[model samples]
Target: MSSEQRVLHTPDPAERENLATFLSRALRLDQAAVVRLRKRGSSLVSAWVATGFETLAVRTITAELGVDDVTVGADTVLAGLRTGHPVDLGYSMDSAWRGALPPMDGFAHVDDVPARALVELAERGADLAREHGGVHGPPASLLDQSVLTVTGADDLEVQVPMRVVFALTAMDFIPHAGEKAEARRIQPTELVRVRATRTWLRLDARYGSVARRLGGGIPLSPS
Candidate 1:
């Protein structure tokens, strides 16, 4: 890591808040989580973290990272974002990241599911999880269960797992019911995109994205 790369600046001054919120949320999910910041083009950077359900949560914000990529403790980055200073991100944890990122393109938009519907599904799943959860939390069967299936043009079909919905709501990607809003949490027309590559299934929510590989982190691709 170079001195210049340690510096973080939002493309539009307000984006720092979004980046900080992202890191903080990721940190809460995994206390020891490391954040992967990959610079995209000259104006955007994508920050990703494993959401502990074998899915990756990603948020892209405008920024200048000075380097193409770097990994740092999400907690540290959160603090840096809050303090508005050049943070000592410490050592690069590029090696700590253990999986492949999905292709930037090549995803076919299989279908669109109403955000409100998915939120309802997540609520029901949460209730079930609490009723059946043990020392390890929700059972793999429940989380892995396919809750919805979409078949689009060309006979394309995608089965969305409960885990994707869980990850989305857990990250506050789509505001939940109890969460108050001037209007509805998600508008009736607001939809979460369900896209797929041969190897990945992606859910693009308003705030961020939750991806499970057709099958892993980003379980939802075959590893």
Candidate 2:
């Protein structure tokens, strides 16, 4: 068997700003307009956002804006785009992300911005967006009132009620350094739920999108 090891890279202040620039160009938003983000419980929750506007543009923008570390796949996407290749902006996000991983604080300083970073950021953003699916299509909205059921083999089912008001879909789930191994999925319509005691009558997962896109934009099914 031919197996390879994956090594992770740490994101520095320069790279973080570069990523922000790439994201701004990729999403066609001003860098000043974009907000720096931190991952909420392994994934970037929508509540962490300043606005209720939920789109892959928002999600991926936040994902790349992360300062702690960058995913190899994301780097590859950026590199490919820089070289002018087809890329897919499509990725997946998961609930219960911090269920197993260690706690990590926010990226670097909040207000830090590097000079001459937009050029590299734009280049990387174009490279990464080449084959990304969400770049062309409408972005995924945040889940309003979704039910995540835990149905194991032998017809054992446990439904968890959840309410997700602010959250990203796929893009945010990519650079979650922790829980990568245990983060497995099964059924398209199935997902793990995160309910808010502060808010009532809310669901964060979707069966319709899963049915339409299959594994593409479907919810996460736990292992």
Candidate 3:
């Protein structure tokens, strides 16, 4: 992987002001604008302002560029777009991201695991749940939630609702609430045992989009 990346396009304060003005004027005509970045070769990038989805007015804003660090900015921008949140283009474009591997707190050494491997395990758990054919349930109550304790390399006891297990396992970091306010990296290990009182899974409302896209409704509650 390239150590550095470049940002092809980002809005500046003046550009934002211009956009706001344009939007105010264009709203009278029922039109909108979108900004896009087009990459050209390894060292060239261009920016374009399209009016109502037009595709021929993009211009190269920056000169031929060398490698630059832009991953965090790009990811933050994408996330903002995905969540329909406002983005501080200035900060995102100028700020530097922290190192890739930050310290992992709250988790035991066994929780140190590769993100890819963890995702794979979650996928496998989901597959198992599908094969078993069970009804989905709501999230477990905090006081009665299942717990998985790990010490070393041992057979994992998979007793929790497969959906919950899959969601938890798929997370890159698990955040904790309290005075400390820290997150822990999930370490991958085989030595673990799960104790779950519930046997059924729950389709979280958040997965509604996935269900809709898959042409299926959330599973009905078990009778």
Instruction: Give the candidate number with the greatest TM-score.
Output: 1
Please give the distance, in angstroms, between residue 88's alpha carbon in candidate 3 and its true position after superposition.
13
C-alpha positional error of residue 139 in candidate 3 after TM-score superposition, expressed in Å: 12
Clashes counted in candidate 2 amount to: 21
Clash counts for the predictions, in order: 11, 21, 10
Tens-digit per-residue lDDT, 3-49, candidate 3:
23332233344343332333332232223323333445654443322
Considering summed lDDT, which 10 consecutive residues are worst modelled in model 2? 207-216
Sort the candidates on lDDT, descending order.
1, 3, 2
The C-alpha RMSD of each candidate to the native structure, in angstroms, is 2.9, 18.7, 19.8
lDDT of 2 by residue, 1-223 (tens): 0112121122344443444334434333222222222334343321111122222222222222223321222333344344332223222222312111111322111121111121223233334444442744322321222234434345444332111112222212212224321223222233423222211111223210001111223223321
Give Cα-based local distance difference scores for all models.
0.82, 0.26, 0.29
Displacement of residue 53 (Cα, Å) in model 2 is 4.7
Q: What is the lDDT of residue 181 in candidate 2?
A: 12
Worst 10 residues of 1 by lDDT: 214-223
